[model samples]
Target: MNQHIQPPTSTASSRIYDILRKDLVGGRFAAGEKLAINALKEQYQVGLSPLREALNKLAAYGLLIQENQRGFRVPRLSRAELDDIAQMRLALEGMAFEQAIVHGDAAWEAELLAAEHRLKCADMTLDKDDEWERLHTQFHRTLVAPCGSVWLLRFIEQLHDQFDRYRRLGPKMPVIRQELDQQHHELVELAMQRDAQAARTLLDDHIRKSYDVALQCFLEHSG
Candidate 1:
């Protein structure tokens, strides 16, 4: 009699992938830290197959780096990588926002305002409140949802995940965060008014502010 072989289940793999991705984005693992397979199995209480599947998916998403001989490790932080992600976001999201403003209807405006409201009600602290993190992601996605470009949305999401890891793991500065909500309010007002150029400029400056904070944190920590 031949032995029976069971293939990896998609449900298990997908569940583990979501869980692991959340952990990675939440900065559960330190940069350049080696991920030991057996230890992870014990920690996540998952079988090997699903864990490996999740890890490979994460690596493909640029959250992890797969070594040639060794296994996977979190990507190391650098100024170059950080700046690249920031610049890409500014260009891509700026385009998306401008198009969204041009194409957005009353429904789009309603949803964007609602998302802003929800996000403002949350803690709004990077890495401090999980609810805030989720709402913030939703709010930004709503801003560009009317852009009507699948590729643009997809790329923006990937870049967001990459940049958010740095935001969550880096040092926090409360003093610099005071103006964020005001910026958000102004952005919503501009979008509602259909001022594409002004909105784009504001959005550009908004992203740069976060980039500056992330850069400062990176420098201080890496110094």
Candidate 2:
């Protein structure tokens, strides 16, 4: 079994990167917590070089902060940062949604609705976090799949990842599943109706509401 292991610099770094990225996003490691090298080596079962490489890659993805001499730490949560991400997401995703509605074909429409349905049916309890996250991300991605700009999709994806981290790190949300499901239905209906302005407005509020929940949750937890 040991004979199959790849060298530390090559395969090991990729493996460590995947685990660390998931851990960071899933809030396994607390935000702003320093990543000690010796501790990580024991936990992840990797050499120093591979661990550093993995951490640096996460830093590039905005999931970690790497400082000189201080080493790596998870990005800290802040109300100001959450507001900034929401603003950016509103503008970028609104533009994408408009373009997608214009450029999307019938198949895209079908897939978009399908993704929404899957999300509605998803098991989003705390125990099924990874599965819930994947479905949620897919549903949102389907909304903008026909924007026809690779760069735009990439940027939005990165923002969504960061924003999602904030959501997960916060305490349990105030919005229950039924209300959320209704909002999702409304969004899909508006998109299907080609009501770009209404849909964008809904999306903006949809995002802001989540941010508000995150803010409230954070404040409550802090208190």
Candidate 3:
């Protein structure tokens, strides 16, 4: 018995786009795996048109790659591509953090402090803690919230999204939690002290460490 499926509206496409974006960024899809539209339609309970629209939007965001006649696949990860993204993050985030140090006021410091506190309080016992991810992202964003440039913030966010996909591709390690927490503590202290030079240096090292971890995991998995 054939079932009648209603045509998808614009809202359906937008909803599907958001869901698909989250899955891609969350590493739900394997790297370089082709997305079979029929399979997705069944899995997501979405029609063909909305699924295609969502996939096309993801392709435009560099989250998916479109082949000539092969439909879309998750973008493959590579050391070169990872390095490029890290370098860009270091450069741009460095600029924004410096400006934040120079211009951030008491309120900004307070917000950053609160965010860091919440991040520290996040439970790490669970393997996939949504609270931790949210608080961690909040702390980083709050650290540079006073950069005073909308475009800079937007670009930084886009770069972070790309980097996060790589990071999530790797298995989460519990051994690094203490070190990461310490780094975040120091970053907060440096920002509070308005030590731009030290803060920037620490931030660069922090970012590089994440890249190294992602690269290591990538090599191990690929090998």
- TM of each candidate vs. truth: 0.91, 0.86, 0.86
**Full-model lDDT for every candidate:** 0.86, 0.82, 0.83
The pairs that clash in candidate 1 are none
Quote model 3's TM-score.
0.86
**Best by TM-score, which number?**
1
Residue-level lDDT of model 1, residues 1-223, one tens digit each, is 4335545466778988998888888889887889999999999888988888888998999989999544999888889999999999999999999999999999999999999998777744544577778888898999999999999999999999988877776566665565666788899999999999999999999898888777875787588
Tens-place lDDT digits, model 2, residues 1-223: 7778866587889999988887787778877788899999999889988888888888999999988754888887777887888899999998999889888889998998899888877744434468777888898899988999999999999898888777776655545434555687788898899988898888888887777656764575456
- What's model 1's TM-score? 0.91
Q: How many residue pairs clash in all the candidates, one count each? A: 0, 0, 0
Q: In model 2, what lDDT does residue 29 have?
A: 84
